[model samples]
Target: MTWMDEFWRLNAVFLVILLSFSFQGAHCELVVSPVVPTLVKAAAGSTVTLAVSFSGAPDPTVTWFKENLPVVTWTIDSSSPPDIAPNYRQVLRMRKDGSLTFVNVTRNYTSNYTMKMTKSGLGTAVTYFTLLVFDNIQNVELHLQPDPVKEGIDDFTLQYVMSQGDVEQQMWFFNAKEIKTDSRYSVEQNSLVVRRPKRSDTGQYTVKLENPFSTVETDMNVTVLYGPDEPILEARPDRPFYLSGDSLSLFCQAEGLPQPTAVWVFGGENLSHDGVLNLTNVQTSQGGNYTCMVLNGQTKEQRQKNMTLNVYERPSGNPVCSVQSVNRNTGLQYHCLWWGGTPLAWLSFPALSNTSSGAGNFNLTVTTSDNLNRKTITCVAVHPVEQNQCNVTASSPVDFLPAVRTTFDLGEGKIVVTIQCVSEASPEAVVSWSKGSEAVISGSTYQISNNTTQLEIRYYNVSSFLLQKYACTCLNPLGSRRREIQLRGPSISDFRLFPNQARTVVTLTWEVPPASVVTGFDIQMKGPNLPSENHNGSQIRGSSNKYRTIQLKPGSARSADVFNLDPDSTYRFRVVPKARITEGKPSEVQILGPGGGLSGPAIAGIAAGIPCSLLFLLLLGGFIYLCVYCNKNKSSRQTRYPVSRAVEKAITAQPDSTPHNLLTGGLKSPPDYNRLHQTPSDRSVALPTFVPPQPVRVATTV
Candidate 1:
């Protein structure tokens, strides 16, 4: 209590003295001026004033404070009018009205300020002010960690940096539009984070920094480099195949920032660096996988696409040609084809009548003509791109005409001549034998036989009547052909043998054989002393005594002379005819003696020889009569016709069967009347009836 009272007594005494001083200072009237602002705002790096005006009788002193702490002190002087003593001299100043001013305002200068004005005779007056120095976003800029946004990628940071300023509020803008925070985008103190940026998030990014006193903005452009979405490569033709000499073009496309670069790769090698690849002439070797690669420099990302290209060629070689139809009426039809070609070209048959087949084939139709066998048909096919052409040919078969062949047999003293026709045909041909227009039958005079492709005619007991025209016909469904033949045999007449004066050699003579069918002759002779029992000389039986066979050389003389004959002995000679295929019977034997004349029994022989010779003459006359009559009516008969002109005579008269002196008796005699030609006109002259001459025997010198 005692300490409290002592403290109160001192406080009361001090209070009484302070009241007296306040009364006296109040009468002096220290007042601040009116119309002064208590708060101030300013831009960073710019001047601002906290206005403090007073109406005091004496100028008041000013003191500045920041955050309730003393900052600067100022007073008015009559000479200087204002004074300043600031904690930071370059920042704060004092005016005569007790107001505070900032020379260069910054964010650090934003605070509450109080100005205290006092004088010796006036009461104390204080003024309060708040200074909001806006940091005009100094050096405020929006920045990206990668500078540009990466499309389809992870988060990217967008930051705003201020060199010297404080921001109370901020707003982000993209392309002048405000940006907000979302799952894809976020906002931190001064940065904007974009999570998983897409291609759509590319544009100008702006930041608006605001304080209580001022507003400012900064902008930066954000580019989102998008990826080349599986770069698309396409061909100009758009087809999967190309010809070897065709033109081709390829285009590569992509979307990206910084204008992505393009690369084309083929067969593991880089082919082009442009967005489009052009090929003037493509080849088969140029076929392979084509790759298009697009690179984005800003994003450091690449995309690629691949396409397969193929080059092909048409088939090249000879075409296949086959016969489609063949017949007698339509001749031949051929089909030409070229298969397995990529692009089939038109086929043509230049030498024939060609028609197009619906497919890549050609047809040729031909008609029968005389020149068809001599002409050739060719088929040609050209490929679209091949250098060579396909060519083929067609031909017909052989065998269309008839050929005739003939043969003869002389086994039983009579001749049998056979004629045959041969030919070939597709279908079996019908063969037949005919005389003139009438078909020949299997009968006595003519025997006809026929097979599929041949005709045979057998003539039995051949005579002048058998030497007639015979025809062989062969026919098929397609066509027909015929062949004719006139067959005959040899005819020998005027047979004689004369002995030389020395009686050693004898010459044999005869008329040329009929029908040139005689190929040769065989002459037989026996010695005067014969082994046979007959009184007249007879020929030896075996081949041992036979004369050497003689061949009729094509153009040699017809006479054959015999040498080494016995002068004083009787000899016999005979002749056998040789034809194309057979030998004729031997003629009657003739007798020779040392007198170079016939040697035989005269008196007895005359008695028999006359009758026999008479009979021979009768038979010869009758045979000649028959040959004439038959030849005259040959045109009317089916199996009769004129024979070949090669025959000189068809009938020969022989002596009677008694065979003595051969009826001449070795004497030079007159021509016999019975020796007449077998034809009518040649023997038309009336002749005396033949009479057997008396067989007079002349004695031969021995």
Candidate 2:
């Protein structure tokens, strides 16, 4: 095969491999950088880091060493390296890229570091790092104390610090034996806390200081310091509300002879260096307890305090409610709502339907059937504050069906009436009956029949005149209605007014009572008034039954305008209402237009009383409502709730007691202040001493 043919065949084979790769992730390749770099200024107990690049794999292996003595190998991970002391002393960090680090390196660990790349082919490449170790990073320091700073846990804080350093300074805590990196003995910043304590943490501890130039070892005594009592965490504002960038002060009160050093922690990270803690911008995440620790070779102590941080947010604007009428007969329901920073909960109805609206709203619904007139509903929003709550109320208009208070009686009759006619009109209506323009007497001879607005002349009426002309009139302000009486005996002339349209078929004339025989003369008419055809008003039919009523010559007029009409007509018609509780007295005849005739005194008295009775009913309703209000709230008259009880107590608490001190002494024991220096004897070195020297020289010569 030609070269091209062979290449194509190989290429085809590769395609099959590529398809397999699609189903599975590609295997990873390991790559390392600074293949031949010279590392500088590496400090002890601190990491000198480099990069490890990888591709196409689940996990990559990176093994590092200095001069092959196996200082430390990062064989399993892409990031973390285990502690191993070696002759050449190498620390390998397994990472694809950033934050690749050497944790807690020692001065003795400096040498040429070589990295091996083993991927896809034991691909081996060696990199040279000229390691430089140093001991002089000015800003680093360390101290040992009780780990949690509590009175109980054996662990203590081992603090090491550099006043100023080029990079982060790592710290390691090791007793005479092995490395224990469990939480009981872990490292934070430059301090090692022995959380899970063992007696092994009490031996001669060694602290190694390293830089790229040299490494220094400091011997330490991890003696047990009596841990402090539990710390009381305190603050000026017990319930804290903090704005961004505001100055907030928090203090930890711990029980110890020497004052405890305080460290603030947030989001699991420590905010302390050289015993100084500062907060710049406050956020909700900044809330937490602060730990104060105190320690030396002999004494260790700590305290923790809780501080709350609140972020301020404005309340939502007033809420709007919507109401609609479903069925007017049922009633109205009002909805109220508002939004705020703090979550709002269930709503309440402190006001009755008649009282209107209430304060402090969440979402409230009131059952009220609105009268067709638009009703205004009010809603209020309330939220919690320190001592008192804040509330804002607003009103909006709503529509609902009003309670129907129509005077509910319909006069029943033998006549057919459509009840539907009442609902279709704007105002309600009333029904009555009349004959030849005269309203019929409501009694046995002229009774109503059927179940509704129907009227029937008594079938028992032996009087044949019962079959005379009559009308059924339904009255209302929107309109008025009257039907022509169905004539029974003969054709009758009927007329009515317009706006006040009625045609009275009868004219009136009454017997002049002989100043004696008059029992209030009966001047009855065929209808509500005198007829327009006065003289011909008298109808003569077959017997008295067919005779239509006629006007009394003395009392009649040509027009039906007899009501309130004067000089032209002298007659007026009136009917006493049938009594429900009392027998109604008959009405007396009255003449219009102020002649020698006037309305009877009884009629005038009845007219004046109708309005006065209505006022009495209103006053009665008001008195009943007042009685109910007084009865409902009889005890513990407190109408408002209070909120600041806890805040008041925190202000009255006491301040803490702890001493402030700095100790300077010998490395192993306390210094004796009384005998720090021995006085030099001034009377010394006498002639005796010179003579003894001369004698000794002569004896040696002999």
Candidate 3:
């Protein structure tokens, strides 16, 4: 190893150490405030301060620079020397202190300046600051927002920015109050916003600000812009609507801020220079398209829209009438209107509502026949153009004649019971009587009378059992009306009233049948008791059931007036009522008073007595007389024996033979029997029939 090499290595190491120490004390270390640094703008005539500190040196030489050029330098007796830039002035003092000052500032003097110093040559230090100087300051620009607003817009915003010679340097003021960005007043970049602008926003807005170094704050007045509101369109007199052949007119009108111009349109066509539009006469074609236009003069805007016009025509034409089905008493009616034709009109028919219309509406009405047949109605419409015609038809309801089965009772063992057949047929009805299922209306005991619509059931003795099913049936030729009859039990109301009294009021009552079967009630009552109850009683005739009672011998039983009655001094009472129950034969008397002369306090009667022996003999004699005398006489006179059917046919077969008697089983053949029987009285039913005569054969003994 050489000593020179060692010595040179030591020198290089010492030099490296010295350089490292110097870097560590100055350039390598940092000087910064935990407090943040800020930039301030100063007006041309204003001044501002900056803060600086060092993390490396406590006392060092300081120098100032404007921007990248040096401005001043200071040293503690060469501790920090002073340096300066051109066109700017500054003075530096504060011996051995770090404070520095500037005087007579100018606009260009404001800049970001840096200073550097060394601590006794042990360290080098540097710092950056803003040196702001103002020559003069002006107003800050303020923006009052809410432009292009509706009438009565209340809210607005006042905002400003700071400036030295630029708009960004100004701040805003509202009514002399400074404004900043916030919720109600916000600045989007530079434009200020005022939410919910209303009438209350009308106020003063001024901007005032200066650079951070300036003392003066200047303000500028601001104003907002508003508008003309929406316009409402109107028309003079009325809207353009007319009926055919009528005069029509319309005018455009509008209301808005600032005068508005109005225009009229017909079917979307603009109107002429004159304000009014006049149509001398209107037609159906004029029914469509009308409009109005409104132009706001202040806003310089126009609007137009269409409306509608309706034209109507007077009602036109009348309806037509026709007839439908016809019957004896039934008829039909029909009506049609001249609607839905050219010229578009309406029609009304009052007569139809009153006369024919009652029966005929849109449809036709026909009267029904008594035969229950439906009647047809027809309607015919005749138009002005003879060829134009319409027709319709309808049917009338079928008619139903209501009728019923009824009965009447004549009190007695042999009652005159009637089976009444009734119905509301158009013509008088014909009735036939029957016993059970037997057709007895034409027989000897039953005389069928078409004139009265009844069958007289007589000649045969009436018995209780026989009355059970005796029926009378009535029918019309058209079969529209039909009814049957029935027989029923009896009604016995009163016998004798008070005995020894002068005349008595006989209380009479009877059972009536179904009202539907009978139109009215026929009634009769009688007194006196029969040998058996409900047997033979005082005769009671056809009872026209009305009065409840009839005056009679008040309290006594009469032997003299006792025939179809109870002669037993114990009086009986019987009644026959018209409507309901038919007499099923004459019923035995109902005993109302005591047997043996009337015994009740008010009833009295005289009785005749017969000896037991005489009664036996009289009964025996009477029985024999009836059997022998009546039978014998009947046999001797029995020639054709009640006109038997055989004899009647024999005689009728010979047309040339003259009928001996209608009751003698004699007749002449008639081709049309119905015509021969009872033709109209208007016309003679007596007509002749042609038939060949057959020889009468005598009974031959062989």
Best by TM-score: 1
TM-score of each: 0.36, 0.21, 0.33
Which residues of candidate 3, in runs, are more than 4 Å off?
1-60, 65-70, 79-81, 86-99, 121-129, 134-190, 193-260, 272-286, 295-302, 315-343, 346-702
Give one digit per residue, the lDDT tens place, for model 3 in 115-167. Answer: 66666645666666675555444444554444443334455545554454533
Provide the overall lDDT of each model, using Cα atoms, as 2-decimal numbers. 0.62, 0.40, 0.43
Would you list the rank order by TM-score, best first? Answer: 1, 3, 2
lDDT of 2: 0.40
What is the Cα-based lDDT of residue 555 in candidate 2?
A: 16
Q: After superposition, how far is residue 554 of candidate 2 from its true place, in Å?
A: 73
- At residue 274, give the lDDT of candidate 1: 84
> Cα RMSD to native, each candidate?
21.2, 57.2, 29.2
Looking at model 1, the pairs that clash are 25-121, 25-122, 32-54, 32-55, 33-53, 33-54, 491-514, 515-647
Model 1 lDDT per residue over 60-125, tens place? 565666777776665566565344444567887766666677887777777777767666656677
Candidate 1: regions farther than 4 A off:
1-139, 314-702
Please identify which of the two predictions, 1 or 3, would achieve the higher TM-score against the true structure: 1
* Candidate 1 accuracy as TM-score: 0.36
